[model samples]
Target chain A: MRSLKKKERDKLIGDFRSGSVAALARLLSLCESESRSRRDLMSSIYPVENQPFVLGITGPAGAGKSSLINRLLFVFRKRFERIAVLAFDPTSKLTGGAFLGDRVRMAEHIKDEGVYIRSMADQGRAGGVGAGIHDTIGLLSAFGFEMVIVETVGTGQSESDVRLIADLVLVVLTPGFGDEIQAMKAGILELGDLFAVNKADQPDAERTETEIKASLALGRSQTAEAPPVFATVATQGRGVVELAGCLLEKYQELGREGVIDARRSKRVEAHVEEMLKEHCAMLVASEIKAFRTKRAKAAGRINPYRLAGALISKIFKAENNAKKD
Target chain B: MGKIRVVVAKLGLDGHDRGARVISRFLRDAGMEVIYTGIRQSPEDVCRVALHEDADLIGVSILSGAHNALVPRLIAELERSALDIPVVVGGIVPDDDIDFLRSKGVRAVFTPGTPVEEIVKTVNAIVEEKRAG
Candidate 1:
């Protein structure tokens, strides 16, 4: 994609501020792609005073996460004037491509001007969410959305990064996911601020919920309460309203306890660290590429550990020389 | 920088979405992000999705012979919303309606038997042109 000129960027920002959904969409695309103007766009919208409430929904594949969100949108739309959903699907590791079909489940809200649903490709980024997701959320908040829901790519046990980004993280599980022992294994179970046993009409739904509650109860003696779990049939809209209510109530409680502010600060710290790491990784990758080419003629069984040390010293030496110059 | 984003939609009452799904996979295999809107989408729904996705192009697969009615409505809706995204039509479009669809602002039309490579190439060229312009 071509980088936008200053004038065009300014116009796009102006349009975005003035409630142009097209401009918001364009800016989001710019963020998702590695456009040169992405930093400029992000910097222009940083420190958004009216950041929307971010709700994250994560679960394993076929857990009815999309269907739940589809129902949740109806409930959220009634309360918030404008709501945006960022639904994520994994990118094919082999092809670096994605078929984002999340919107298909949420199709009922397509024509509602109050609702903006965007399907995101994970773009090979691990930890559930996609690259540039933070920037995407910032842009949506700056666009005057009152709520932004992030539906993570169907995650396994290890992808709990959604807890870092969302003000409230709801982990959706289905019947026969596991027993109490499975819940106690950690990772995803520990990440949820709220839990839902979707597909509640199934025979094992109550048993699954009981196991989750038992595990959560065993884990939480310090806190006054364990995370609440609700049984839901998302397709039928059963138990969704109560789940939505609990979510909003929990968010308010977190805000009252100043937890939200603390979480935001931690998120900012992590974001900076991640950005620095990515930049340094790029530098190291390029340096390695150069080193490989330069040593191509003298191919031998060189120790990788020694080469790594040499590469670091070379980078530091270059840095010092550049500073001196 | 960014991968080309395309919205492949099945417009109208057409439930025959085999072509749309195949094209979606083809686009994905070619290293583009493809959002398949599924079947039974209205023109407005397609336009809204394209706008929200900031899609570079829209490929509408109409196997129900509703191309003449639905494609123009889609273009009109895109125009109405001030979205400049280009569109292409595929599936069961008769040869005679190809020119008509193009004149109605459809960038390309592929009837049955159009090679997958050709479709991918056409999509890439259109998106590149759009980005360049």
Candidate 2:
């Protein structure tokens, strides 16, 4: 993608601010690619005061996350004037491609002018959400969406990055996920602010819910409140209204107690730390690549450990010299 | 550069979506992000999806012979939204309607026997032109 010129960038931002979905979509594409323009766009949009309430939906594959979000949109749309969903699907590690089929479930809202849905490829990010998710959320919030719902790619036990970015995380599960032992496992069970046992029409639904509650009871002490688990049939839209209402109530409760502000501060801190690490990793990778190319014609085999140590010292020395200058 | 994003939609009451699915898979394997909008989407729904996705192209697969009616409506909807994204038609589109569809602002059309590689090449070329232009 070509870098946006200053005039073009300004016009795109202006159009985005004025509620042009086309401009917003183009900006999101820019965020997904083109790191330099992404930095410019984020710097321009980060100062916006409107921070959309971010709700993250995560669960294992075939857990009805997308279907649940489809039902949740109906309820969320009634309350928020404008809503956006960032649906993530994994990119193929081999082909660098992705099949984003989440919108098929949320097709009912396609014609609703107030709802914006964008499908994202995770771009080889091992975490549940995509690499571009934070920037995408910022763009949507700056575009004035009152709520932004992020749906992670089908996740496993350790993919809990959603907890960092989401103000409220809802972990969707299905019947026969496991007994209390499964719930007692660390990682995913601990991340949910709320839980939904979707596909509740199945026979084991009540059992799974009970096991989760039992595990939570055993895990937490007397004072800590356990996250509520609701039995839902997302395909049939059963028990979803109550779930949606509970989510909204929980969001408000968090806001009233100043937890939202605290979480946002933590999120910002983590985001900056991540950006710094990524920037330094890029520099190190380029340095290593250059080193390898320059050493390609050397006669002797290079010791990997020694090369790494020398590179680290060289980077540190360069940093110190730049700081001194 | 970012991966080209394409919205492959089945417009109208057409229940036959095998072609759409196959094309979507082909595009996916070719390194594009293919957003499959499933079957039974209206022209407006397709347009809205294209707009929200910021798609480089819209590929409409119509097998129910509703191409003449639905394709024009889709183009009109795109014009209504002022989105310059290109559109391509595939699946059961008669040879006679190919020119008609193209004149209606479709970037390209493919019939049943069109090679998958040809389809991929056409889609890439259209998106490349769109990005360059």
Candidate 3:
């Protein structure tokens, strides 16, 4: 991984600003890491304009989120020319690497110049989505994609973080996976602005739909329109266009209600907090490593909490001195 | 602490992806994002994916004895695209052809029985050097 030199970085930024697909891909790779280069790249493109509407697609591994997203892409492409898909598959807990196979499911748009698809390995960050996902979304939005769809490996509760980034989140579920009530127990069901009962062609489709509707009826507010539930056979492209239309309508309604602004604000807030938390953790780990190397004699005697407090103080003191300087 | 993005591919008509999958797991364990391009990927397909993914390095696991034909074409494609990604070859390379593969711009080569840790270390060192320079 070569670090982008100043000249190259500048040129890449220039191309990226001018809408070069190659440059955007490189910039995305830069944002994927936690490095000085990532900082440089972010600062170079901060305060994004023409922000794309972000839609989150999340479900269990077997829930067909990829196929659902593929269908949505087709429907969305009819209205929005520039669309970017960020698919995150879980990283192996035993090994940090992942084999992201969303491309196989999304083979339809491989040749479309308007569509940009990228897969990210969820490297066990705080949430189901990778730590860099927010930044990646910003990059895609900044790169002028009209819609940026994020498909996460929504295994369970932790994936609820999808709400923090997407203005609208679709939770897809298939029939016969389990009792619909059991599936909804994880609070993941509540996070969705829309519910998709995919594989509607299957034998249990109607039962699944009824179960979801019953669950929603029990939980949702009676005052507002319940989040529309769509029966979708994603592979067959059934009910996709209607779902897409409903999504667009909901997006417009949200925009009219000033909800998009609030959601975007929440997204930014979460991104800042995550970055700060990671930075502080990295700083503490480095300080502890240095302390361990330098104070060999005091290793056993020193209290862990005291050392942590001392390191935190030192970091703040250094920051204050730098501010004064 | 950024993720190292790697493209693990099997080029030509090779149907056996066990070695590629194993190496992918090894690299992933080593904290790199391994994008396995499945099996029977063309040189053009490999290079396109490598570039599109902004891969830091590409690992080609060849077992069909097509290394002599495929690896160079992959390198050529990368050169043509102006992508400066390093290439590593694994599996079933004749001992005599190691230097030839190296001469064709393969940064590293691993044969059967090479420890996975060694491959990881070599890749890390090369990546670190590239980043530092």
Q: List model 2 lDDT by residue over A134-228, tens digit each.
A: 77888888889899999999865855888888899999989998877777884778888999999999998999999988876775778989999
lDDT of 1 by residue, A34-83 (tens): 64367777789888888789999999988999999999999988899999
lDDT, model 2, position A142: 86
The DockQ scores of all candidates, in the order shown, are: 0.80, 0.84, 0.37
Any runs in candidate 2 off by more than 4 Å, and if so which? Answer: A296-325
TM-score of 2: 0.94
Flag regions of model 3 displaced more than 4 Å.
Answer: A1-9, A20-22, A35-37, A275-317, B12-16, B61-71, B90-104, B107-129
Better of 2 and 3 by lDDT: 2
Ordered by TM-score, highest first, the candidates read: 2, 1, 3
RMSD, every candidate, angstroms: 2.6, 2.4, 4.0
What would the per-residue lDDT of candidate 3 be over residues A183-260, giving only the tens digit for each residue? 668676788889888988999988887887777777557785667889999889999999999999989999999999
Query: By lDDT, who's the top model here?
Result: 1
Q: For all candidates listed, what's the TM-score of chain B alone?
A: 0.98, 0.97, 0.97
Worst 10 residues of 2 chain A by lDDT: A33-42
Candidate 3, residues B1-133: lDDT per residue as tens digits? 3567888888999889989988887887787887777677889878877766778789999999989899999999899988888999999999888999999999999999999899999998877776665
